[model samples]
Target: MSPLHRLGLATARHPWRTVVAWLFALVALGGLASVGGGEFQDNWNVPDTRAQAGVEELRDHLPDAGGSSAQVVLHDDHRLEAAVVHEVVADLRSTDHVTTVTPRLSEDGDTALLYVRYDVPTTDPAIYEDISGLEHATDAAADAGYEVEYGGELPGTATSLQGRGELIGILVALVLLVIAFGAVLAAGLPIATAVGGLAAGSSGIALLAGIMDVSTSAPTIATMVGLGVGIDYALLILTRHVERLRAGDAPVDAAARATATAGRAVLGAGVTVLVSLMGLRLAGLPTYDAFGFATAIAVVCVMAAALTLVPALCALAGRRLLPRKERRAPEVSRLGAGAPRSSTTGIVETREVKEPLTARWATTVAKRPVAWALLALTILLALGAPALGMRTWPQDGGSDPKDSTTRAAYDLVADEFGPGANGPITLVADLDTVDRAEVKQVHADVAGLPGIAESGPVTYSPDGKLAVWDVEPTTSPIDERTTDLLASLRSDVLPEGVDATGYTPLLSDISDLLGQRLWLVVGFVVVLSVVLLALMFRSVVVPIKAALMNLLSIAAAYGVVTLVFQHGYGASLLGIDHAVPVSSWVPILMFAVLFGLSMDYEVFLLSAVHDDWLDTGDAQGSVVRGLSRTGRVISVAAAIMVAVFLGFASEPAVVVKMLGVGLAAAVALDATVVRMVLVPATMTLLGKWNWYWPFSSVVEVRGAPAPSLETSDDERDDLEEVAR
Candidate 1:
């Protein structure tokens, strides 16, 4: 058989391939899950500060941080009397991990706070299990005639990570997949694959973290990306394969042909996505490097599953998969061509694409590039306008709302007490020495800083050599006023002290660090994409255009995301209840993931156009027809991604929300607007000029195509018809 027929037969035998792949993945998944952290978080969200200088500093100064920590809170105040606190503290000290505990007077004096410190490190693997025993410790309080009420970080962090993160995410993810894929089983399969695939990937990350800077966020990202791309891509291929089968071929033949064509598309798209994500390595931030590596791992595994495992499963469970197909027929267009369309509710059955932009849409867009391009550019810019005004930096969620307060507290304090009440500005001073007078001078200077509404006393490092202070700025963390004040201190204030002594300054060095890395990160993102695309297209111009397109997409999506999340505009309607920061890590991550996904579409759509141009030499016809043929699946894949990723927008955390929303928007726009129109139209304007530089030698290309473009209209027609 020819390569075409061979691919068809392989797809028809997809069941076996799937079984083999699953068997392979399952072993890795099992090993991965065996060592999951019960409740440790990497705390990447929390930037390192002079830990001894902040609340810890205050607590240290207060004479005791060793307070009795509470695990569960009770609404009844009378139950948490002094008797209850004393008894709980007494009982907790008996536990091995509980080094000491002290009871405290609550803000009201009617209620009280208990501070607890562990003899063991919080990073210990058994911390959750040990901390979970707190309820029993509280039970001891009840015996002493007090209803023990409790609350703190140990409970919240442990419970959120161990109990809620995956459970809630899994449930939500499944519902999202069903909604996105329009088939329950179809959606479920990808989720299952991801569980296994991501599990293995997370294990690698954790293992890597043991030596590198990989943190708890790495796993969250690993899992999320694994599930998002894995399911999204698998569902795309599956849906396409089923559609091809419904178009007339047998299950076997359909699987094979779809495997060859759509599989190739899926594989090529996966490669592009992987390439895009891998580009983040260029950013030079070790965290981003780890993220880039982990993300690349997931993309690779997801592609493997989508092509090999999914295909094999199709072969094995060819007909039984429609477990609900009999009932679903009326509502879904299954793989069986003769199947009848049913109700409109289930699976969102439809012959046409969802919310149809209208079939006439293409013709209209084709007719008026200037109008649509202007309109799109206008909308994107308008969406991004809020971003130009955006401000953000790293923040630590650890102290915000503290340990005792639940979700009930953040807004209450931030609103009535001012946003500054939530987080304090930490000042780490590497003075010439820890001389009492020098320390006192820096203290007075920082305290006098404009935004310093309040300041706690400074504390010396272990050797009494370095002092650190905590300042509660009147301004919010991300406010221009605060950053301005910080800059002023760094530029004007720090130099005076530093000049007094020949010692290097913290602010000075850090400033230089950020300045150097900024351009490096930008250059990394741009250069890698250019190199990858150039190699793929063998045209420097193509790579440049692809990079430009990706930049436009990222900028546009970020603009809209900032508008929705940061400006609190339409957030409520989207189920976002309050304003939020655009995750600081989002820019680079979007660069990697979106760049990959956008380029995925780029390869899928453009390759066909390029193939046409190569074979028959009609760039215009090839562009139009290529887009037309690939348009449907590209739209479907993008739509599926939109649903999966946008589902994550419901997450309260900005990072998860950003990843989902940013990615969804980028994929959707790139497919519909960029790939379909801008690319085609731009190429149209360029005509044969697109292929010209093949003769020039500005950029590198080795053994690249020396396409003989000379051809007739008849030849172009034949190639175009065949390619379709």
Candidate 2:
């Protein structure tokens, strides 16, 4: 027997032992996480990049100006007193994390801006707690009839997830499973397996946090992937077991057969996902590496649970897994069949059947392969057109929810001072000499540059070798104009010795680096996917076709994200009130995730087709049979994924919402348009060439005749056995 069959038998025969083992592991990991798990670190430091070099230079040459900074915007309908501003600045200086606080009054005398610097990075979670005292101080100023708002990364960091959306996603997944299975136990088993997987995966991430800098977004991304695949893998195996039980097979035998066949598909699909996620390391970004490791761990835990815990649950429930009506029906007609006939012994006799809708659809596509293929391609191309116009940048306070204090402060500053007041570019100069007249001349030259709103007085380091100038832009931080301004300053405006470094310049550098590396990451994932699929199916054409189709689906998803979020098409529905550029890292991350996930359907369907092709040696017949058999299961699995992903669409963070919506769309399109329509049409057109490789001559005759749909009872039994 295959190892999968043996595993299923072991779990089935000793359900209690398997259950206890899993429970013990889950509890032990949870305890370990609670006691020893370290906090998540959002380390945005990209090494060897301009941003890193700038940061290093500042820390080395000007230690006092090397920390994360925020702006406190105070406004009063009446004239603000200078004494009150000084008091507020003093209170801010006394805050635990604060290193310095400097206040500046607006010319109108009604607005005050206080620049506060912290010893820690903006992405550090500790800054949030430390900012509480500053918030309290601001509250006191507010009581004195001034409006206090925080404008910068500090307020943005305070918007951590409430986790309600994740719960809702699971609930929705449960509902979809119930609809798919029609029985409570059968529906609950996948959810149980998924929940167990999620617990283990989350705990693993927490433990991993202690060893390295893991992004705060890692948990959410990992959970999204883990739950989707966990439920999917279990569902595939459970569906096969049900099919076996509906036949005349014994419960244990059915479980074993199901695990051997469908479970193998699950295993293959899981490996593809793991490979694709781990390929994120090729992006040469640390955050991507952290995300890759965390998500890969989640996928591994969930896949293991699906292979073991799911079968154990199935064994424990036995026939009780189905409803009473289904269990009592001794010889029910096969799925998608018309009706059962009464045998002479009063036992109902049934024949193996195909889903009429999916079968007819497949036949139709097979008849006019070119038309159907072109139609699917056209739809994808149309959906993907918007991607060409996509713009990417790191998320900032300007993109925060309107109700957030950071956003309010950003608007306040933009209104009173200038839009660029929220993000000022800094010039760090290694001066030949620190002469006051020469520094003044340098500041004057910078102030005369285009797009410069105002340039502050040059501040010299204590050692008197480094000089710094704060130059505010005329546009918001994420504005394209601001990016152009930085480019102009770097190439034309700044003197030879001066270097620009600040939030704006760092983000700009990061964005540029991402754009350059995006292709490398894509090429890595594509090449890896092609190689993996080629080896798995042993067919060059099949992998190439699958890769192209997956890219189409992902591109379509990107276009949808751009249209909705960037173009403000459905932003309000997803809780985004303003249009924002896609997050710089989101496209690469989304591509990795979507490629892996779309392959789930690809592997499951193609594996079935390959099995059918080998059995009958008839390419067209295999396509029809495979589609008819796996169509319903794949559709249901896609539905579950879509539900889980879309559930996170209401996430407060725009970046998270972008991921949720993009993933949901990609899965939906892949299952329906790509899998059901494009794949079948293309494979039908390929005929015998679908499985052709350099070694095709050794396998079989090149022109084997296609078989008829009907077959003898023995042949039908063989087909059904293989299908399981």
RMSD (Å) of each candidate, 1 decimal: 7.9, 4.5
Top-lDDT candidate index: 2
**Candidate 1 displacement at residue 624 in angstroms:** 2.3
lDDT of 1: 0.56
lDDT of candidates 1 onward, in order? 0.56, 0.83
**TM-score of candidate 1 to 2 decimals:** 0.73
lDDT of 2 by residue, 457-543 (tens): 788878777888799998998899999988887787666667788888888887888888888888988898899899898888999
Q: Compared to the true structure, candidate 2 yields what TM-score?
A: 0.93
Write candidate 1's Cα lDDT for 586-697 as tens digits.
Answer: 7667666777778777877776566556544555655665666567657756665676666666554546666777777887888777877677666666655565556553
> Which candidate achieves the best TM-score against the true structure?
2
